[model samples]
Target chain A: MARIIGGLTSSHIPAIGNAIARNLFEDPYWKPFFDGFPPIRAWLDEKQPDVAIVIYNDHGLNFFLDKMPTFAIGAAPEYRNDDEGWGIPTLPSFAGDPRLSWHIIEQLVGEEFDVCSCQEMTVDHGFTVPMQLFWDDWQKKPIRTVPISINTVQHPIPSPARCYKFGQALGRAIASYPSDQKVVILGTGGLSHQLDGQRAGFINKPFDLMCMDKIVSDPELLARYTAHDLVREAGAQGAEFILWLAMRGALQGHVQKLHGNYHVPISNTGAGTMLLENAD
Target chain B: MSTEAITQDIPGTIIFNGEQAMKGYALNKMCYSFNKADSRAAFKRDEEAYMEQFHLNAQQKAAIRARNVLDLLAAGGNIYYLAKFAGIFGLSVQDVGAQQTGMTVEAFKAMLAKQGE
Candidate 1:
């Protein structure tokens, strides 16, 4: 009975948080990034989904080099705002919906997906940055969340095929939920940008556009892409595109682009945003 | 190494080999129960009784039963495996710290300082 309102994909740069906190939206460089996200902002205001299932990769913040999870889902009542070394000027902790999260977990598992469920999980900039951009006064809202933590930081990460399958499982699970509440699936991470070692500051606008095109029309081809392909084209860090596939797959091959935008050189990364509504 | 050799060899290292990895059905079952509304309550009422159904080894069981992050890492578990265990413990690596040393964040910092002494 559950309905997916739509999907939102965005880049999560820590610098964007700094800019927002300092009220530097008018700054020339940051302005383009903010402008690109207007569609997401409008979608959030108009759709107002009951819960947002966010797929993101945590960067050495919640899970470090010591241990990581290829995929972990949050089933907690509330999640505190993390201090990723540098603090977010004045943002409060985010609230979570444990009941709905548990339901989704149960449904997904029933549909035959290997899921890691956590009761007390802290979200890093990957999640908070996107939330800050999409919501108005996110800290104060009663937002329920199902945080899907992807392992993009470490080697031998999930394959594009696997991520897409997980997304399909997620769609099946959400559809199986007995509630009639509306759900929004947000895929946060990248669209061609890399950070780390010599490959830092790589951006492929052609590949980014191609990714957008495939996410909506030719997802089957996207699923066949190996991590090596994404790495070679979009750079290693750009491999976070796997997270976006999960969102695309969840729509079960039904997607309509609401808006799309791309900009580069934001704190040494290419940033982009895309809004998709379920056509099925 | 040539691309073909590297590509073929990669799977053997990460993915479980032989029969160990053939748990697609079991994985699905676990996923289903995990997502259920009464997952926490069900897990709490009879965790051992529930896990017994999995037919995992002592090492696997111990990893899942681990109370913190230290226990998980010390068990020679990978991130995905550790994640399943961490989920059961309701703990994160940030909370548990390194297991072999049993050092808190501050304690670890202190130990580093002692090296300077």
Candidate 2:
């Protein structure tokens, strides 16, 4: 049976893509944010998880308003990235575990999650940025991936508690798979920052700190926040905190916080990065 | 659910719920097309003709014409879609936020930086 090694979280804002492209890590303005990744990369190198499940929100790339799926999973053999109109350089395609994806999909639907499974999906920065952060030169050392997209762009997104439950279902599905593969779950996006309306530059550092702390100790408290409550406290886009909750849910065993870094104003976001190790 | 119940009252924010989605469909569809380089070029060639193709209403057209972020939101524009439109003119979220809040780019950035302290 497959074993879940741990879970990771990173803010997947598009500016991080541009920053990586420009090789701006050492630049003073970017160093604090860029500095967060070395420890994560070192851990990945040591553990070397074979497959990664990325939980992220599609920002108008793969699915638009015409037909938005509340919860979608990628079951393709390979997933590709495309230009999201900011002219950011698109990354190379990522290999997918179709067999494992089908297994998880079957299990999830059986569990009554009713997720949309996609054979073809265009992953945006939300899925790609974290991969870049965790594994530099991902092209040379590739990891098979599965992308789970939650609708955060449009309103009426899934509640935090519901997402946590979905994560728990996902954990069971992965553990039940008949494979020797090791897996890592990545919850990408947000601490707090809004980019719309007159409240565009909103950032709540205190709330963000409370979240990062509680997500490790008491995710139930974080999960208790309604979507509206999250939007009010974490800003509109900051509601992506649910993604982190979903990642947390997948770690059913004893968990420990390995490392964490929080930085402000990364392309109008309160950037957060955390790595949690699981021990059964 | 009642309309008032579904529609949140987050200050300076508009929830892009079903009502806003329905209202902004045409405008958003137009912006979503900007994902393709050729579509962006087509819109650049003739903005008026492009808006016509998307069947954008007067309010949406005016919002696009004015390049006002607040007005665009008032016309039911979701920021994600409007971002593609904003990209045409090389505007980042900071630029839009500055414009909407009536602050210079530096001031808006300063406000964001101060949050960390």
Candidate 3:
């Protein structure tokens, strides 16, 4: 049966995309953030997961406010990136696994977690940036991807608790798939940063640190936070922590944190990265 | 939960709830079109006409004219969509952030850099 090998988390800030495009890894402003990925990349190179389930939030590239789904999953044969009204260069298309996608979608629906399934979806920076970070040369040696976007743009987004449960459902769905395909789950975006209002550049390092630690050892504790609390503590956009929670929920057995890093002021956010392997 | 009851007094933050989404639909719909280069060019060519085509409210238009992030938020603009509107002027999040917080871009960048230290 298909099994989840591990889960990874990273901030999907748009500026990171620009930095990558400009090849600013050694630049002072980007060094710390860029430095977080090499260890995780080494692990990916070793494990070679067949597919990656990327849990990220869309930023107006796919679903808009007109038809926003609280939880949406992409089942396309390929996923592409487009301009997000910003000037970041678009990345190449990602291969998708329809068989696994439909399997998980059916299982999620069967488990009573209604999710909007899309066959044609354009992933934004929130999805693409992390893909680039983890597998910089993904186009040369691509991995099948399944993009699951949670609503972070609109309010009433899924709570940390709800996202955890959804992740648990996802874990079950992946475990049930009748294949030997290895899968990796990526919960992209946020450690704390808000980009609007007077609190536009807000970053809570202590709160982010606490949440990052708890997301590994005691995710249920992080799940206790209401969406409102996340906004208040982590900043409005920092509430993207829900994506990380979903990624954590899918690890079904003894989980070990193989590597982790935390950096601040990555384009006005406390960027975080973690690699947790599941030993079942 | 009621949007106001939940989102009240979150200093310097605006929750993009159903009410705000409904209020800003026309404005946001206009900004969303900026995703396309041609639409962005057209907006740059004649900003008012482009906004008019989307039937933006007086407040939204005024906010757009003022180029004030806070006013745009009050006009029911979500930051993600408003970003497209800001993109037309080549403004980054840090730029709009400085505008909203009344800080110089240098000071704002400094402030962000300080968080790490």
Clashes of 2: 0
TM-score of candidate 3 versus the correct structure, residues matched by position: 0.98
- Give the best candidate by lDDT: 2
Question: lDDT per residue, candidate 1, A139-200, as tens digits?
Answer: 56666778889988656778999999889888988887888878889899887654322233
Candidate 1 local distance difference test against the native: 0.68
Give all candidates' CA lDDT scores: 0.68, 0.93, 0.92
Q: Rank the candidates by lDDT, best first.
A: 2, 3, 1
Which residue ranges in model 3 land beyond 4 Å of their true spot? B1-3
Residue A32's C-alpha lDDT in candidate 3? 86
Candidate 2 has an lDDT of: 0.93
Instruction: Give the winner by DockQ: 2 or 3.
Output: 2
Candidates ranked by DockQ, best first? 2, 3, 1
Task: Give lDDT tens digits, candidate 1, residues B64-106.
Answer: 5655333333333333334333444444332333333354645
Q: Model 2 over residues A1-280: C-alpha lDDT tens digits?
A: 9988999999998888888999999999899998988998999899989999999999999999989999999999999999788798877899999999999999999999999999999999999999899988789989999999999999789999999999999999999999999999999999898999888899999999999999889999999999889999999999999999999999998998999999997988999999999889
Q: Look at candidate 3 and tell me the lDDT of residue A177.
A: 98
Q: Extract clashing residue pairs from model 2.
A: none
DockQ, each predicted model: 0.02, 0.83, 0.81
